[model samples]
Target: MLNTKKLLALTLTLLFVFALIPAAAQAAPVYRTLDEIKADGTINIGVFSDKNPFGYVDENGEYQGYDVYFAERIGKDLGVKINYVSTEAANRVEYLETGKVDIILANFTVTPERAEKVDFALPYMNVALGVVSPDSRVITDLSELSADDPVIVISGTTAETYLIANNPEVKLQKYDTYANAKNALENGNGVAWANDNTEVIAFALQNAGYTVGIPSLGSQDTIAPAVSKGNDTLLQWLNDEIVSLADEQFFHKDYEATLAETYGLDYEDSLVVEGGAVNAK
Candidate 1:
């Protein structure tokens, strides 16, 4: 009887200890603040590796794009080395929520649905959904699309949400990355390719056989950096950075340097979001 009681007590004690252990072991991921990142001397910025004119790796294996230009400035001002983490549109929120990235510079659009998951910094660029198609045929009406004629869309983008809600019957050939979507469009996999207007406009401008038939669709939106929700220190620092950079016309300068070659000088005024102020300060 004594032995059995001792064994039972030991089991209860072990069970109690384990019950408390999980509380510590399964603690939520803690995100690093500006100070912590400064101390480490590196900021992990998540960016798309396959989206050209916004974010992509060049033939020489170097990161180059409009968003990357802004990220480079952020690193230079913060006095930290940039550790660029190649990310996809779908994995952006996961990167922030899981503490895998200090900031997301992957052309993240500010939306109420996304703001609930991650804190978005002030606007840095203007954007809207647009559709591009082969010059032979332009799709202006969503009603024209059917299962026989699909639309190429990148996963986890506003384009996906807009189509599903507005035109559910339109068949979607979803790609996890933008490069694949571009390929599918070129290969005649879909009737039209939908994405950010800025990106689609760039595509139409640079590529020969495509044209942006629908230049603007859905609501006008802005692109901004995103940090882990509740990370106020980092958020404030980024906001301050934006305001400070505005004095120098930094974003316009970034456009001139990286995007203007593809988009030309005519687009400078409409696209550039100076000092993180979407409107008046």
Candidate 2:
């Protein structure tokens, strides 16, 4: 129906667009796990960079801590280079969900709420709530805190939940991270700091005038690695790794190597998890 030149031009245009249709269809999906890692050749790991003796940067600008040690091992096992992503407590899940990190070894505590969003691997460490106050005036009992005085807690932590549900009389001054909560209590911003027993004990021992009271509060909880939701492949792999590591009592070894100097002998049993259970070293 057209002249030779016009008909040829129209046919070529149609062929060109048709060619692009197949190319577009052949392109892979954006959020693929295996292909993404294969392309990057590195497994990104998320960890806390401020919470010392667990995950922190040292003097040499190297990420050094208990979690870092494990992250290195994971990278080795995965046959991929380790790309460390420094993250906060609140940002850990976000990092995983956003694909910023393949795994989280950030001392993340396993909870039912978090599990709904992300899959938690088998626990490698045990933890519970504890309170730390000035040595001169320890708060052993919740009743000791005045109605006017608020406790310091890191937001999005078990500490905040525990205090809100259990101690309605006590007000809370919430910070976003462990470093801020520790600093606030150190500066006498609050009468006491409530958080993980391991953190509280470590803080008390690190600073001179503070001591941990109520060394254990609530049921024992396990801290574990977490991966994005629906990531059954990664989740299963992590759980298997945890189980294998537990058989060797690797977590106890991790505790002695990384945490013992900070906490001393008294906390060995309270903080370590071995063979799918909390054990004394």
Candidate 3:
């Protein structure tokens, strides 16, 4: 027994609620399948433009690095061109989740927390945490750092997570980009910079008067490509491709071509993980 005006208001409210359902459904993460990517003729890959020897834009403006080499092979094998999307450490997962990029190759370390958000492909490289500081007062151990001496870390990295979890006494200077973190260290913003061992080692080698005092700080981890959650078709294809690439020792060659100068042959067998088979250490 409702009046005309009251009935009209009720009907409008129902319509409004119904209208929002489709929009809510559309807001869920969208994943493009492998076939769709191939049909598009191009795959978007997210990589760090500033993280050299891993993923970076060279002086010539070409994307060159270990991860870039692997990305090139993926594109070739898929019969598609690549569109490199510059990304930062903090935005890697967002890029995949939002469908902004089909794959993330930005030195993404595989961690349990990240695996729950984005589906990780097989690992291509092994990694660990390291700390680099000025040669004047090398920080060989976390114990050497005073409570006032802050450590530099990149946001959304394992280094930041580890320190936050393990060393509540230590202060941290967080940056969004690897370049900024390096600059912060050079500017003496922090006493030490904690990051991936590969990156810190490269920094010490390239920049004079810096030493990787705490090489191998945390547990060993692996670097892998990541796709949006529920992108099963692409995930499966990547796994298959990784295994297929093992026949030619593709990852080892990638290290030789891109990482050898920085890491040298001694790191070859240790860092390279062919066929995505990570032997239990």
Candidate 4:
């Protein structure tokens, strides 16, 4: 019912809008597999940039941590150049689902709900929730925390989920990164920071005047590599890699190389996961 020029203009506007749709949105979903990834000769791996001892960048600007060490070995065995992608805990699943990275080695904990989203390859480390607070007044009990004196937890971590699910009344001050949460804890933002026991223990070890009062707060779990869902070829390769590495006592070597300084010989036997199982090295 419009004039020729107006009708033409309206049709062109519609065409332009359609053309502006992102190619990714318009095309069928593309899932990357092992062969396709290998053909590219570079594997993108996601790891935390701020979490220390487990995954972090050193002063020399080189990424160094237990998970990063394991990721380096995967690149070597696969004969591919490794591309390190710095990821946050909250974005670990997103990075895999969107193909931003081929593998997540950022100390990803295996949980049934998370398993539904990404395929966990094999466990390389064992972890459980622990709380750290100022040595002056350690927080050993969760009931001690109130709304005004809450606990700090990293968003998208098992600690947050566990607390929210099991203890709905527990108040939480959630942060996106470990560094931020650590700073908050130091600045008296919360009574304590609840995180992986290894991380908290490392923190207490590295810094004075802080201690892990609650060394083991939640259920024990395993840390493993995660690939995009339905990535069977990649998952199988990773599982095989885990077994092959175990035959060499590689996880023990990994602990010696990365985790030893923080935990020492005392925890060496209790924390390492060998051959995809929770076995002390």
Best by lDDT: 3
lDDT of 4 at 202: 86
lDDT (10s digit) by residue, model 3, range 1-281:
46988999999999999999898657879778999999999999998888778888988999999999999999999999999999988989888888999999999999999998899999999999999999999999899989889999999999998889888788999999887888899999999999999888888988999999999987999999999999999999999999999999999999999999998899899899999999797
Clashing pairs in 3: none
CA lDDT, every prediction? Answer: 0.89, 0.81, 0.93, 0.88
Off by over 4 Å in 3: 1-26
Per-structure clash totals for the candidates: 0, 0, 0, 0
Q: Which regions of candidate 2 are displaced past 4 Å?
A: 1-39, 278-281
Better model by lDDT, 1 or 3? 3
Among the numbered candidates, top TM-score falls to 3
lDDT of 2 at 161: 78
For residue 261, what is the lDDT in candidate 1? 86
- Model 4 clash pairs are none
For 1-281, candidate 2 gives per-residue lDDT tens digits of 46988999999999999999888656532232644665678888898888889999999888988888788777777778988888887677677666667888998888887887677878878888899999988999888888777899988787887788877789899998787887798788999989889888888878898888889887778898888776777777777777788767787788788888898867777677765555543
Each model's TM-score, in the order given?
Answer: 0.87, 0.83, 0.90, 0.88
TM-score of 4: 0.88
Superposed Cα deviation of residue 6, candidate 3 (Å): 36
* Cα RMSD (angstroms) for every candidate in the order listed: 7.6, 11.9, 7.0, 6.2
